[model samples]
Target: MDLRALTLLAGANSSGKSSVMQPLLLLKQTLHEDRYDPGPLKLDGPNVVFTDAGQFISQVAVGQRPRFEVSLGVGKDRGRLLYEPSAAGVTLSETGVSVGQAPEIIMRDGSVVSARETAVLLELPGLEAEGKNSIASRHGIAHEIPLVPWVSIAVVDGVLLKGSVEFPAVGWKTHLSNDLMRLIHLGGHRGNPSRRYPRSVSSSDLRPGVFHEQAAGVIAHWKQHDPASLDALQSAMRTVGLGWSIEPVDLDATAIDLRIGRTRETSRAARDLVSIADVGFGVSQSLPVLVALIDAKPGQLVYIEQPEIHLHPRAQVGVADLIVEASRRGARVVIETHSEIILTRIQYHVAKGTLPPKDVLVHWFACDPKTGDTTVTAVEPDAAGAFGDWPVDFAEVGERVDREYIEAAWKRQSGEAG
Candidate 1:
């Protein structure tokens, strides 16, 4: 699925919204193990862990091989990798590379190659001969030329042969690889509120869902090294209507204490700081999310699941503003949420021109009862803040409850009159 600047995945439980994100997380984990020799896409690793192939694959057709494909790109250049489960690990089957339109290269042998072919030949090792022959057969060209550096292509007789080709350097791939290294994912079930958060010098990226485990440490690190980040974090917290501020207290060299500050009103003096445990559960749950967003660097992607958890309706709406602001700053954001308030706020932002409509994309997922498989449908918002083909059942419980209340009131009045 193609992702925009800000993408939302919304659906009921068991509707496969998370399925779309699993493969990418798996790839990130695998690449992290060894970027150069990452043998197979890992099902289990530092980012995510799946039990086995059966659990990883969505649907297994009878007598059909199970596999998944992951494609990534930066700007116009694109690359894809096909993967299948093997006894040892996930195996990469095929690779495809596409470089945007570039001038055709002419070899001394009179053979020509397109920019796309040149990219593929350079990326895949030992494919130069096959690539050259295919190009020659398609073009019906013949020439006798030896492989040489800076030569685009060579041919001998009717068959094309491998030649030293200087491929255009594309920096997007390296940038994409670096992005994969620093990817941050926060899962739906996050760490529960604790009295204190432990400190770690090595924990740089936020862990899946367990971000709360390192929340205080992250804040402390930024506070000491980059205090401006704490300002950004506090600004985000205030935007979410959480008046409290966060500060880290050194318990020891190995541990840090997280303290919550109470905002003072115009008429009141400054209030004393309190332990994070003393605040509401929602504050604790949202702290890590805000911290992660504020700390994200430009071009880095942050994936958040159910960020509205434990938040009030207004706070949920506010979180949408945070997501939009983050996207506007060049940080890619992918969110999976069931909160209508968040969706409504996003729609409002698009309608009001706070965010461009093209930059926002929404995917609704549904489950097939008979097959027990999940299906995804794309829903686009118009300039008027209305979603075309809005699902009738989505977030309809409030309306249903209102109808039930009206029915009960009518029944009571009739019985009293009778």
Candidate 2:
């Protein structure tokens, strides 16, 4: 995904949307939990949890292993892995790591090969890696065993993992790790309002979790340490039509709560009047999303599920405004939404010439009932706010509903007349 592009992922239920995102999330979860090196893949963690690799494998491709590929920075860095599903966890069969710095993997013996060919060369004796998170082993020629045991190579730091390549890296690091580490996720029980939140458990913590359990703390961090960022946060909140400015109140040293009140322009008093819990449920649900988007720095990826949840139809337009504005501000946004109003507003931006059509993409996913496979149809808005394909599933559903309703009404009217 382009760092500045606004991409929307939408589709029928269980049409493999989550499956596409889970691999990156798995990488994030694995790095987050340091208990094990987790050679190639992590089966369970906070973002996504699973007991067995078979749970992640495709049912149709029964004989094949559960494999995944990752490319970030527009394929500047990429990796591919094939793992054997096990009862306890998955084991990697072959792995490949490559980066864009030199466009080639430099070997210890001065033989340079294209990074793209690493996967095909995994079984053969070749160059190994050196340095921290690096591995070098020649099975027969060097009489060495595989360093990572399950996998051939794993690269976390592209530059740092560089040594003389004889074998691949041995650690759970990757060039994409930094991007994934900085990603912002807004989800879970954030819609559930509470009167107060804990100040913080860790001062250095950044991720707010799916429920945004760390949201209030992050807000307060900006308020105290980075007032300029807090201003941006407040500005973004106002843009979302929340009207009330955000203020963090300290109940004590250990507890904190957020308050929202109209600004001087909207109210006579600039003082915050009510806690976040006192607002409408829609406001509470939208708060975390706006926070996540606003908090995202330039080039930071923000993934939000159903951002328009619990919002009134009209208010969803504000969500569109936020999405467009975030992309313009250089924050990469990936929104998985089912709201027509939200999508329409974004389309309107393209139609109005306010946003470039090339910068906006809508991907519609559909599932084949018989085969259980998924396909993606992508489109970008034109000057008329028209995408080449139906951007949301509800459009067809609404038409079918209208047709069914009219048919039933006609049958009932004929019977009455007879």
Top-scoring candidate (TM-score)? 1
Among all windows of 10 consecutive residues in model 2, the one with the lowest summed lDDT is: 142-151
lDDT of 2 at 281: 74
TM-score for all predictions?
Answer: 0.78, 0.76
Q: Give the TM-score of candidate 1.
A: 0.78
User: lDDT by residue for model 2 over 17-55, one digit each (tens)?
Assistant: 667777667766655555655545666666778877768
lDDT of 1: 0.67
Give me the runs in candidate 1 sitting further than 4 Å from their true place.
34-38, 102-169, 198-214, 239-243, 263-271
What digit string (tens of lDDT, one per residue) describes model 1 on residues 303-396?
8899999888878877888888888887888899988888889888998998888888888888988999777888767887788766636558
The alpha-carbon deviation from the true structure for residue 103 of candidate 2, after best TM-score superposition, in angstroms, is 7.3
Clashes of 2: 11
